[model samples]
Target: MENIGVRAKELNETIVTLRRELHAHPELEHDLPFTESVVVRELAKLGLDELKPGLGQGHGVIATLRGKKPGKVLALRADMDALPIREETGLSFASTNGNMHACGHDAHIAMLLVAAKLLADAREELAGTVRFIFQPSEETVDGALSMIASGALENPAVDEIVGLHTGNLWEGLTPGQIGWKAGPMMASTSTLTIVFEGKGGHGATPHLTVDPIVIAAETISQLQTLVAREVSPFEPAVVTIGKISGGSAHNVIAGTCELRGMIRAFNQETDAFLKRRIRATAEGVAASMRGRATVMFSGDLAAVVNDKACALKMRDIAANALGEEWVKELALPSSGAEDFAYYLAKAPGAFFYHCSTFESSEGGAECNYPHHNSKFDVNESVLWTGAAAMAAYALHWQDRN
Candidate 1:
C-alpha cells in the first residue's frame, strides 16, 4: 500500500477547512440536521457505491463502498455531536451557536470524512466492502445502540470494526501520536439517582423534622465505603456525586433530597458489585435514620473491550502508515466512558486515541484543556494523522482478514 500519511498530508488543507467549518457551527445530540447535511454533501462528492441517509432517527448516514475483489467486510465509525457548552476557546472559528465541540467530535467528523475520500479514491485496490458509519447523540451514550438497532451493523455483516477518538487524555503522547490498548480501553458508566425522603419542618425546630439534609450528608459519607472497603483495591471503581439538590430556603428543611451521580467500573463483576452495594448502602443508611432512600440506575454504557488481535494489527498498521515513533501502547484504561463499547460488543474491533495537543504558535500556553471543558481544542495539524490511520487500517484490514 502507498504511504497513507503522505496521501493524507496532501489533503491537510481540506481536512482542516472542514474541521473549522464544523467547529464554527456545532450541533448537539440526535438533532444534527445541519451537521448531517454537511456530511452528506461532502460524502456525495466521493461517488460511493451506495448512500443511505436518515439512519438512527434521521441523524446517521451510512455509505458503502464495494471493492473490485471479494473479501471480508469492515466498518469504520465516527461520531457527530457536540456538547451543550458555550465556547470559550477564543479561536477565529469558535462556535457561536451556544454549543461547543468540547469533546473533539468536530475533529472526528472531519478526519472520518477525509478518510472516506481517501478510501473512495482507492476503492479499486480495496477488497470486500467498507461501511462508513456517521453516528449521532454519542454524548448521551445511546448513538451506537441506536445505529445498531437501525441495522447499521447488518447488511454486509461487518467482519471487524475500527474507530478513533481525538483528545488530550493520553497525556504521555504528544501531538499526532496514536495510543491504543489490547483489552479493556474504557470503563462501564451508569448514572445513579438516590432520593432521600423525610419530613419537612422549620430549621429552628429541628427536633420535629426528620431532616433529610442530615441524612443525605450521612449517606454521602457512608457511600465512600463501597469503594474503599467493598470493592477490591486491584480493580478501579469510581462513585462520584456530581449534583445534590433538596432545600429551597434556609429556614425550612426540605422533605426530600436528591443526589445524582455516576458510577464507573472496568469489569462486569465490579460494576455489578458497585451497583448492588450502592443501593444497599443508601437504603441501609437512610433506614438507620428516620428517612427512606430510593436508588435508580439509568443511561448505562458497557466497557469498551478491544479485541487483542485487532489491536495488535492496528498497532502494526498505524506504525507503517504513521511511523513507529507515532504509535504507542497505552498502559492503563481510561475511566471515561464511551457508547462505542456497544459497537465493540456487537463485533470484534479496536478503538484508538489520537493525541491533539500542541504548543501554541503564538507563544501562549498550549491548548491542553480536557474533553468536556469549555475551552477544549485540538491541534489541527494532526487531524490528517487520524484520517491516515483510519484509511490505512481499512485498506490493510481487508487484506489481512
Candidate 2:
C-alpha cells in the first residue's frame, strides 16, 4: 500500500505556495474570479484534462480523475469564497483588500487541490473515480445548492460525498486531527427580520407619543423568552439578534426599529415552533404598546446530519491511517449552521472538522473569536493532515465497493 502520509512532506511546498497565493487575493461570496483562475491553472498543471470549470458560476471548478477500474463514484468539496472581514493577522500574504479568508477556506481549498494532485498521481492504482469540487459562496448564499443546481453533483453520480472544515475548538490537538459525529452535527438556521412601527414624536413628549424604540426593546426582551418559556430546555436551541437599527439621534423618538437575527435548532419541530413563537411574541409585544410589528422568515438552511454508517466507516479509516489518537468521537453537536446540510439533504455524506492547532499561549489564541471574526486566524500545519484524511477515506470507501 502506498502510504498517503508519506506523500505529505513532498507536497508541503506546493501546498504552502497555493495557500499563500489564494490568501493574498481573497474574494467575497458569489464573486470569486481570481480564485477560480488559480484553481484552473493548478488543475491544468496536474494534467487532469477533463476539467469542468464554472460549476457554480463565479469560482467553482470540477475535475474528474479517472481510476484503473470502474466502481462507486466519490465527490470531495472545498469552499472558495472568503468573508467581508478585513485582514488583521499581518502575515506577508494577508489579504490585499478588505475581504479576507479568515475562516480557513484558503486551507480548505489548498488541501482539496493537493488531494486532487495526489489522487491524479495515484490514478493507475485506484479503483473508483474521484470528483474534485471547488465550491463558492459558502460564506454567504448557500453555495452548495448553486453547485448542485449547476450539475456538479450528478455528472459523475457520486455515491458518497465528503468535506472538512478547519476549526480551533479543541486544545492540545494535533494539526489535521479529525472530529466526527453522527445524527445532528450542525443546527438548522432561519433568518428573522422584525420591524416595529410607532408614531414619530419629540423626545420631550410627556405621554402622547408611542415609542417604537421602547417597543423594539420590549420585543427583543420578549423574544428571549420564546426559547426559554416555549421550547424544551433539554432540546438545545438559540435565537440571537445579530443586528438592530433604529434611532439616529438621542433627542428624537425614532418611528421605526429593525431587528435582524437567526433562529437555530437541531430538529424540525423545534425549529418550526420557535419561528411561530417568535412571530407571535413580536406582534403581541408591539400590540401591547399600541405599535405594529412585522416579522418575516427571510431565509433558512437545514441541519447537517451525518450518515451513521458513513461516519463509522470514516472513523475506522482514520484510526487505521492516521492512528487512533487522530480519530475523535464528538459528543456535543455544533450550534452553527452549514450549507453542507444542503448536500447531505440530497445524498448520504458526512462533514468533518480538522483542528487548526493554534498554540494556547499565543496572544491571539482566544477561541472566543469563533469562525467569522475578522481577526480570526488558524494554524496552517493542518493542511497536509486534512488532505490525507480525505484521501484515506476515499480509498477506504473504494475498498468497500
Q: How good is model 2 by TM-score?
A: 0.92
In model 1, how large is the Cα lDDT of residue 9?
86
Clashing pairs in 1: none
TM-score of each: 0.96, 0.92
Worst 10 residues of 1 by lDDT: 358-367
Candidate 1 lDDT tens digits, 42-129: 9999999888889997789999998777888899999999999999999999999899999999999999999999998888888888
Residue 235, model 2: lDDT of 92
Query: How well does candidate 1 score on lDDT at residue 6?
Result: 96
- Clash count of each predicted structure: 0, 0
Tell me the tens digit of each residue's lDDT in model 2 across 1-401.
37886686467677878999999999988788899999999899888737888778656888887788778888889999898888877788888699988888988888888888878787777777888888999877578988999887787788889988886654445556888878888899999999999988788982777788899888888888888888887999999999999988877888899999999999889899999999999999999999999999977888888999888878888777777887787877789777888888777989888887665555544643567777677666556778877888877775654
Error (Å) of candidate 2 at residue 3 is 1.3
Task: Give the deviation of candidate 1 from the true structure as CA RMSD.
Answer: 1.6
